[model samples]
Target: MIESSHTSPSAGWAARRLAELHLAAVFLTRLPLPHLRPPLPALSAALWAFPLVGAGIGLAGGAVLMLASAVGLPGPLAAGLALLATVLLTGALHEDGLADIADGFGGGATRARKLEILRDSRVGSYGVVALLLVVGLRWQALASLAANPLSAALVLTAAHALARASVPWAMVLGRPARSDGLGAAAGEASLVIALITLAVGMVVAVGLVPALALPMAGLMLTITAGIGWVATRQIGGYTGDVLGAIVLLSETAALMAATR
Candidate 1:
């Protein structure tokens, strides 16, 4: 068999891309991978693989759901356990972001106040309420979908992948809120990376559930964009907390749309 002109180079690129994916997975989730201790620049470059990391998280959640269900748990309980698995997997990273952003936006009267609120370690009333609402909605939506393990797993996978895919777009559309933080440190992902994430998300959505694909995509995009807009207007730009909030909210929106 004759090798194509592009074959060797493409193969090499794929191999390197796998490293980026591992970095992204490590950064985004608590899952153990061989530690490479790549520099910040390499981690920033790995942003392209964030969605794939999300997909892995979703699969882990689904596996939890399946195990719970097989052990005689009800859908609601299984769904809750599955959601819990994801929370643990990601160290509730985005959940914490959602709470901080909520508290900051709700309590702050000025941009400075908002940023300060975001920095505080304590959770306020706004943060508590936001977590309740988000977590409750997710549990309910997952329960509704979890009646069939296969369907629920597929939806979870698609929801997670698509939700993360929105982050690069959000990053590209909004500037960092400050001189330092994960948001600024991430720099600006290229349009190519953004589009690739979007494309991968679309494929996951359509492949998982053709009927809900358009609606899920629309919901995810709208929610993510709205988040970006709100973050920019409130804080002058995005921060690490803002990006985390975007991912969690987008995932919830996608799951709700998929279930409906």
Candidate 2:
């Protein structure tokens, strides 16, 4: 019986919301689902449900790492397993985005060319470097926080929520690079969804550390705005890869900031 202003109540809100959640899963991960044409509606809803998706990822990662530790896995090994679990769960979708973006920006001479480069499947040197740095940073961060798994889990939760929240703001402020693409679908993401995402992010932050919630919120806002600015200037708009890059960068930045 839950109703969201953005979607119809009479259209079986529960079913629609569940569908949206499922769509979010599909967008973020490699979860199997029936194919559908015109994935915009589902993708849009997925953007809104990003925080929940992140929570699920956090729970899965925490559980795996804890289980590994319980079985006498070393802290470093447990952390590695948890990281691998996250990559596998998400199907490395964001990682692919990050790599493509790196290749595009590094190789292209013009904006259009950059976009074209991003669409290419082949990875370049810049992409390889970017992947290494991102993965290495994340692994190191988790390892540093290994002594406190609860805090590590909270960090992951906050990072995922805040990272996804950046996409809506980017869409709102940036132009679409093309007449049609993932960015266009993302641009169609509603304000209600954005608000929902922000609310969820705040809730996760506050739940993690009551005293640090305000600071974390401020950090999240600042990082999101910064990334949005970069997306606008560099690409002259947003794209799926751009959104993915935002998620990866924002999450890394938030974790780094939180640690300090």
Q: lDDT winner among the candidates?
A: 1
Give a tens-digit lDDT track for model 2, residues 160-185.
66666766766665667777778775
The CA-based lDDT of model 2 is what?
Answer: 0.74
Q: Name the 10 consecutive residues with the lowest summed lDDT in model 2.
A: 35-44
Over the stretch 49-84, how does candidate 1's per-residue lDDT look in tens digits?
A: 887888889989999999998999999999999999
- RMSD per prediction, one decimal? 3.3, 4.4
Residue pairs clashing, model 2: none
Question: Which candidate number would show the highest TM-score if scored against the true structure?
Answer: 1
State how far residue 140 of model 1 sits from its true place (Å): 0.4
- Candidate 2 displacement at residue 166 in angstroms: 2.0
TM-score of structure candidate 2: 0.86
Cα TM-score per model = 0.92, 0.86
